[model samples]
Target chain A: MLEIRNLTASVGGNQVLNGINLSIQAGTVHAIMGPNGSGKSTLSNVLAGHPQYIVDGGEVLFDGVDLLAMPPEERARAGIFLCFQHPVEVPGVRMDHFMRAGYNAIHKSHDEEELDPIQFDRILKDKAKIVEIDPLLLKRNVNEGFSGGEKKRNEILQMAMLEPKLSILDEPDSGLDVDSLRIVAEGINQLRSPDKAVLLITHYQRILNYVVPDVVNVLINGRIVRSGGKELAAEIEANGYEGQGEALQPSA
Target chain B: MTTPDSLAQSEYKYGFVTDIEEETAPRGLTEDTIRWISAKKNEPEFMLEWRLRAFKHFMTLVENHQEPKWANVHYPPIDFENGVYYAAPKTNPASLEDVDAEILSTYEKLGIPLEEQKRLAGVAVDAVFDSVSVATTFKETLGKQGIIFGSFADAVQEHPDLVKKYLGSVVPYTDNFYAALNAAVFSDGSFCYIPKGVRCPLELSTYFRINAAESGQFERTLLIADEGSYVSYLEGCSAPMRDTNQLHAAVVELVAMENAEIKYSTIQNWYPGDENGVGGIFNFVTKRAKAAGNNSKISWTQVETGSAITWKYPSVLLQGDNSIGEFYSVALTRGYQQADTGTKMTHIGANSRSKIISKGISAGHGSNTYRGLVKIMPKAANARNFTQCDSLLIGDQCGAHTVPYVEVQNSSAHLEHEAFTSKVSEEQLFYCRQRGMSSEDANSLIINGFCKEVFQQLPFEFAVEATRLLEVSLEGSVG
Candidate 1:
């Protein structure tokens, strides 16, 4: 569903992602693990079309479309969802209204009829239960004054509402407690389908225990150095990246 | 002159005028003109005498004064001698039903239905065209509730005692140049009174439109809420497009007696000049409300999005013990418009309180300024005041400024003021766009969010209307 070829990105003239290549197919979960300053978050941001990150060279193809040529909103409408590690707190925009706007934009882009308030509300209430996000949170301003855990859960709730084709969870488990982690994992599991793909970016294996990935890629020095199966994640958790020196080898 | 094709493609929707018959006064200011206006309105002899006195004062003030240049405003010198001082609706209606159809259609075009069934519920309307009161609806119903709802002319005639006692008592003729001009040649506005111990049953609204070319609208509105009474008054203004800049100098005075409460709201959407600042209304107004007697309260809420050059300060005199005063405003300036607006709150009584919240949005080459003052007199012991002023700039070409003057004579007074000015950040916009909102939608959402604090202060219906007005006012630039 997604393809990246030699993606070299820079922000403020500082190269953040240098010649990184990756691919993901439908119905598969991929995990990208890296230490601090390893460009894990930058990869997610560049894929979401953040204007600050200038793609110096290379290509990103989503379902055979030129993803790099699209604007951020067009990318979102093309079913590319980025769950921010630090969710933005947008004051005065009610969560329900924000969700409806996101839903309508994607739905309209795909030639689907938009849902009215009544129909949308009924669907949102049921989805809120799976994410363990209180329905009352939808009435308040989007993520305003919410705790860190609540913000992460809110992002998951949005991900559920959008039902994007390629979902990038950027450290979604960083702020979640044990129970929230399980709930977020359960929500992702429920959203799994044959036509959807998931890319999980994380620093710990706690979340991987709940939503196991089919493949794990170790990112270092702005490149994907190694790719392996789920056992690679377990091995990295047991012995830190210090012992896995081969995984740090530069990829051609 | 710009081609019609060029001007026709302009996006200002309310820049057109309606054709109607008018009885216009000859251009120029003189004792004769004042007397002519008094006679035209069939004013009482005493009122005529007062107008003559004001006219004399106007002549003295104009002769001794040079045009004040300190207001941060630039406009061609107003040729007072070549401007019409008064114009009244020639069609007099014995009842609202007998009103002129063309004039009624003008209101209808503005989406304000004059018919009772289609009128805004529980809101009495006093419609003013140019310098005359065309019609006042719900008069009988308001009168049954012991409310005085009429034009300023009628108030001067039937309720001379009340008019004479309160007129200029709060804002004297010498308050400013425009105040003096308004006092000398003011033609018409609304006069509302809620009797002592009686709560007004409905919202009192007045709509002012400058429909005549070269005609200056100098309207004076006075609203009095008697002891223990409460009233809410709303004012709206608009003007037709004219190459020669038109002047609109209005004065509004409000009085809240002991235990009385008054809420005055204004939505000023007069014609702002073209993008290059060619033509529009030059609005210079002086509006003040005094809270007299103990436990009185007065509040001013305004949404100002129009006028080529707007200079107005809606103020409050908190003279009543434990009185409360508030000013909430959202001023938007697009194209070449310039607005210097805010409020002044004076605390003279013990335990008085005041709150001021001003939000300004500037786009294109527009300039938005917030000039406010809060004064606590020596006698106002333990008084409190809070002010928050925020400005949002849409484009780099625009400017936003804040100047607040605070004076606290009482050692026990507590006052806090905060001000911030910022442009919409690219990061914020990108965040919303990443959520599937277009740049225009993102900008509008951010602007609306920035103004939510002040917009929420308006009544529910007015809030909705104000939001829509903000959206419409920010159309071209936001996209």
Candidate 2:
């Protein structure tokens, strides 16, 4: 459902993603494990169409469409979701309104009838339960004064709301405690389907323990050097990223 | 996808002029010009003398070059002599039916229904068009409650004693350059007074419109809430688009008596200049309220999103024991607009309190500044004040500034002031965009969030209007 061909990207004039090739079919969860500064977050940002991350030379295809040619919003409308590493705090914008706007925008792009507040409220309440998010948190401002765990849960809740095809979870487990990690992983698992895909980007294999990935790839210096079954995550978890990139393919 | 930059370049929506025959005084601010305005309104002897006194004081300020350049705004020196001080529709309307169709349609176009049947329920309106009150609705209904509400001209004619007692009591003619100018040539504005112990039955509002080209709108509004009374007043204004800058200098005064409470809200959408800042209204207004008796309260809430240059500070003087003053403001400046606005709270009695919340949004080359002051007198023991000023900048080219001055003479006074300046970061914008909102929608959402506190203070209808106004004003401000 998604393909990346020589995806070279840079931010602030420094090349971050150097000559990367990856492909994911439907109903598969792919894990990209790397140490810090290994461009794990950069891959997610590039897919999400962040303005600062310039595409120096590359092309991304989502379901045969030129994904890189779209803006952030269009990419989102096209079912590309990137769970941010650090959720931005938007003070005074209520969680319900923010979620509802995004949900309705995507729905409208698909020529679906938009749900009114009352209708959406019921659906939101149900989604909140899937993630075990307290319904009251939806009344507060988005990510303002929220605990790290709550922010992660809120992102998962948004993912549940949008029901995107390609869900990129960027370190969703980084700041979570054991309990929150379970809830977030359970929520992601509940949303998994045969026709949807997940790109789980993380430095550790702990989250993989809960929502086991179908494939695990080790990323080093912006290049995915090794691809194997789920056992590769356990290997990285034990040995770390050291000597993981010795088989790096030369850049095109 | 539609680029927001081009969308923001849309023309000001309320820029259409009303083609009506007007009776205007000669262009200039001479003594005779003031006399001509006073005669045109058929003012009493003392009123004429008052105008002359204010005119003399204004002339002295002009001679001394005291046109208040202290504000963080830039504009060429105003040629006071080249502008018309008075411009009113030719036929004065004794009733809504007598008003010209053109003038009435103008109000309808501006979303203000002046006709009785079509008027907004639970709200009384006074429509002021270019130096004259064209229509005032629900007069009889308010009069039955002993609430006197009408035009300033009518107040002087029908309730001379009341008008004389409080016209310049709060903002005197000697207050400042703009106040003096407004006092001298002020043509028409709303006059409202709530009787003792009577809560005003309806929301009273004044809508000011500048329709005639080259005419300066100088309107003076005075509202009084007698002992134990309560009232909420709203003011809104707009102007037609013109290449030559027009002047709008207004003065508003409020007096709240013992146990009385007065709430004032303003949604100012005066015409801002073109994107390049060619010409617009130079809005220099003076608004002040006095909590004159014990336990009285006065609150000012404003959403200012118009005018090329705005220099106004609605203030409150807490004189009675345990009195209170509050100011909630949201000032949005886009394009070439500049606004230097905030408030002043003066604590004169023991246990007086004041709260100020200001939000300023600057986009394009706009500049917004929050300049406020909180002063506690030596005798005012245990006075308290809380002030918060937050500014949000949309683009890198715009600017936001906060200047607060606090003076506490009493040891028992407690004051807290918090300020923050935040840019609409790319991260936040991108996050919203990635969630399916367009860049423009994301920008508006973030700005509305930043201004939510102030918007909550507005009346429901006005809040909706203010939100839409902000969206229109900040269009094309973001990529």
Candidate 3:
């Protein structure tokens, strides 16, 4: 469902992603585990077409469309979603209003009829239940003063609403309690389908236990260093990132 | 949908000039000019004397005052002697039926329903044409309830005591250059009085339009809410597009007595100049409210979207113990428009509190400034004031500024101020875009979130109108 070749990007003149290559097919879970500052988040941002990250060299294709040339919104309309690690606090903006606008926008771009507030609210409430989100949180400002777990759950709720073809979960398990980790893992498991693909970006093997991965890739210094199966995550967890040959490279 | 080029060429919606027979005073400001206007309104001796006093002070200031260069705006020097002080429709009649057909149609074109049957439900409108108010709707019903609402000229003739007592009480003629000018040759505006313990049932509104060419519209509004009474008043202004700048200096005085509350809102959409800044209205207005008795409250909410150079500060004087004052403003300057607007809160009594929320958006080479003042006097023990000013710049060419002055004489006074300036972050825009929203919609969404506090203060209908107004003003502004 997604293809990346020679993906190189930079932020503020500093190259973050250095000619990385990856490909993911439908109905598969791919995990990219890396240490801190290993360009893990940069990959997610580059895929979403963040303005700050200048594409130095690369090509991306999503379901036969030129993903690299499209803006972030067009990419989203084409069924690409990224669950942010730290969702911005849009104070005074209600979660319901934001989500409804987003949902309507996605549908509108596809020439589909949009949902009214009442219609959208019912769907949102149902999706909230799937993600175990408090209905009250939907009434509050988006991500304002929310607990860490609530934020992660909110991202899951967005993913469920968007129903994207390819979902990039950027460190979705970070800062989550053990109980919240279970809830989050359950939400992701239920969202999986034959036509969908999920890319799990994390630094820990804790979530792999809940939503087992079909492929485990180790990324260090902006390049994929190792690729294996689900046991690879457990191996890295058991021996740490340094269990294999130098998991991190010294700065040039 | 608007492109950058199309936005620059977009026509002003309310720009058509009305051709009605006119009665105009000569283009000059002298003792005779003030006297002529007073006589035209058939004012009493005291009212005429008040005009003479203000005219003398204005002349003195005109000699030395340099138009208060502190404002973040620049315009050609105004020739006070070149503008006709008063211009009324040629045939002055006794009732709305006798008014000129062109005048009525003009109001219709402006989307302000002057006919009693067609007026917006729950709103009583007083339509001011040029220098005089030709039609005032729902006067009979308002009068039956002992609520005196009509033209300022009518108030001077009928409710002299109420007019004399409250006029200049909040905003005296000597307050500022524009206030003195408005006090001198001010022709006519809306007058509203809510009797004691009576809650005004309708929204008392005034719609001012400048249709006369080469004329200045200086209207004075005085609203007094008696003890235990409540009232909400709204004013809107617009002008025809012209190359020569028309001057509009208006004065509004609001008085809330013990246990009374007054809410004054304004959607000032005067004609901003063309994209090249050729001609528009120089809107310099003075609006002040006085909380005269204990437990009174006065709130001001304004949405300013137009005017080539807008210099106005709607202020409040908390003079009664425990009185409250609040100001909510959203000022947008686009297409060569410049706005320097905010509010002032003066705490004079114990335990008084005030809040100031201002949101400014600058687009299309527009220069917007939020200048505010908060003063707590020595006698105002335990006074509290909270102020927040947020500015959003649409394009790199536009400018946004905040100049806040805070004075706390008493150590017990608590003043909290928060100021934030942002360039409508690319990250926030990307976040919204990644949600499948258009760039323009994303910008509007983020701006609306930023201004949610101020929009909440407006009435339900006006809140929706204000949001749409912001969207229109922001069109094609982002790159």
Candidate 4:
């Protein structure tokens, strides 16, 4: 469902991602884990087409289309979703208006009939329930004063509403408490489908305990250092990537 | 904004002028200039004297003043001698049927057709073109309810007593420099009266359109709601595109007597200059309201989205014990436009209260400022006032400022002021656009949300118009 080949990118004249290759198939969940300054978050930002990140080399293919050629909005229209680690708080925009606009715009790109406010409200409420979001939050400004857990839940609510083909959760568990972590994992598990793919990025194994991954890759020094099964996480957990990654490799 | 209508993308939708013969006063401000305007309107002797008095005061101000250097706006010194103080279309149709077709079409293009105005329920319109009131609609129905709704000129000629009683009652001619100039040569504006104990059955509205070139429009509006009466008045004005700047200094006074309530809403789309700000209207207006008796209430709501330079503060005086006043404003300055608008709330009676909400938007090279004052008199014990001012900047090239003044003479008085300023960052824009909304749609959605508080104060029809006006006004502000 998604493919990245030799992707190299920079932000503010500093290299973030270099010579990275990854691919994910439908019906599978993949997790990327790495220490700080290891390019884990940059990988997701590059996939989301953040303008600040200059793509220095290579290409990305989503559903057999040149995803790198698309603008951020078009990438979103093509069913690519990025759940930000820290969602922005738009003080005046209502959550209902924001979600409805997303739903309508996504439907519009597919040349489908858009839902009216009343009709969209029903779907929105159902999605909010999937993530156990407070219905009252829907009426307030978008994440204006939402708690950390609520912001993560809102990203899930939007994901449920948009129903993208590929979902990238970028550190979605960073701000969640124990119960919220379970709820967020449960929400992600519910979205699992034969035609949908999930790429979970995280720094700890706490969330992996709830939503286990089929594949785990260790990223380091702007590149993926190793690709292995989910057991790779347990191994890294026990023996930190001190001597395993290229950082400890002998010069030349 | 929803679909990028050509009307929004166009430089200026209501920028076309109608060619017609006009009678213009001499292009100079002199004692005779004031008398010529008063004489042309066939004013009463007392009205002439009032104009003379205001003219002498205005001259004195012109000699000592420095063109209000305190406002957060810059413009070339106005050529007072180059603009005609009055210009009226040369046609007097005894009835709507005989009115000129060009004049009728002009109103139709502005989306207020006099013929169909009667078909509109609960809305009576008085269309003012240049310095004259063109045609007033739905008067008979309003007249049946003892409500007087018509041109100020007509009220001066027919209802002289009512006009004379409230003309400058709230905003005296000596109020400000602009008010003094407007008092000296003011032309036709809407005049409305709700009789005692009678609630007006319809909304009294006025549409001011400035079409003549090199002309200054000084309109005067007076509204009086008697004891136990209620009324709502809406004003919408615009002007055609012109290469030379036009002066628009108008005065509005509203009085709400014992147990009376008055609600006034304005959506002004005066001609804003081009992208570079070559020429536009310098709107210097003084709009004020007075709660004259116990339990009286007055509310002022304005959506100001045009003009090259806007310097106005629609204020209210809570003079009666337990009276209430409110001011809600949304001002947007795009391109090279500059606006310094807010409100004033003066509490003079015990237990009086006031509330003010202002939103300022600046995009492109535009500059927007919110300047407000809330004063509690020494005798106004237990008075209360709450003020909120928010500013939104769309681009890095724009500017926004908030200047608030609070003066309380009594220890028991309570005042609360809240202010916030934020920029339309790339993160917010990208977040909205990533959800598939176009940039324009996203920008307007954010803006509409910011202005929802003030927009709710407008009539339903005017609310939609205000939204559309903002969409078109800031069409090019967003990337």
**Which one wins by DockQ: 3 or 4?**
3
TM-score, per-candidate, Cα-based:
0.94, 0.97, 0.94, 0.95
- Candidate 2 docks at the CAPRI level of high
TM-score of 4: 0.95
RMSD of each: 3.2, 1.9, 2.9, 2.9
Candidate 1 lDDT by residue in tens digits, A1-252: 899999999888999888888999999999999877889888998999887888999998999999999989999998999988987766667888878877887788788999998899999999999888889989998778888888888888888888889999999899678988888889888988999999999988889899989999988768888889988888889987764546555434
Among the numbered candidates, top lDDT falls to 2
Clashing pairs in 4: none
Error of 4 at A16 (Å): 1.8
- Positional deviation of A1 in candidate 4, in angstroms? 2.1
lDDT tens digits, residues A1-252, model 3? 899998999989999988788999999999999999889999999999888888999899999788999988899999999999988777678989998888999999889989999999998999999878889889998888989999999999999999999999999999999999999999999999999999999999999999999999898778888889999999989888764435434431
lDDT of 2 by residue, B411-468 (tens): 9999998999998888988999999999889988999999999999888988898999
lDDT of 1 by residue, B176-280 (tens): 778877887888899988999998888889999889887889999999999999998888888777777888999999999999999999999998887778898
Write one digit per residue (lDDT tens) for candidate 4, span B1-479: 22212212237889999999999998799998988988888999989999899989888988886457899999988767556999998888787788899999898888888885334577888999999899889888888988888889999999999988888998888899889989999988889889999998888899999999988899999999999999989999899998789999999999999999999999988999877788889999999999998889999999998889999999989899999999999998877889999889899889999999999988777899999999999989899999999998876777899999999899999889899998777787777877777777778888888999999999998999999988887776666
Instruction: Give the lDDT of residue B138 in candidate 4.
Output: 88
TM-score of chain B of 4: 0.96
Q: Of the candidates numbered 2 and 4, which has the greater TM-score value?
A: 2
- Report the C-alpha lDDT of model 4 over A1-252, residue by residue, as the tens digit: 898899999888999887888999998999998888888888888888877778999989998999989878888899989898888767668899888887898899899989999999888887888899878889999889889999998898898888888999999999789989988999999998999999999988778888889999888888887878878888888888786576435531
Model 3 interface CAPRI class: medium
For model 2 chain B, the run of ten residues with the poorest summed lDDT: B1-10
lDDT of each: 0.86, 0.92, 0.89, 0.87
**Candidate 1: residue B470 lDDT (0-100):** 87
Candidate 1 global CA lDDT score? 0.86
B409: Cα error in model 3, Å: 3.7
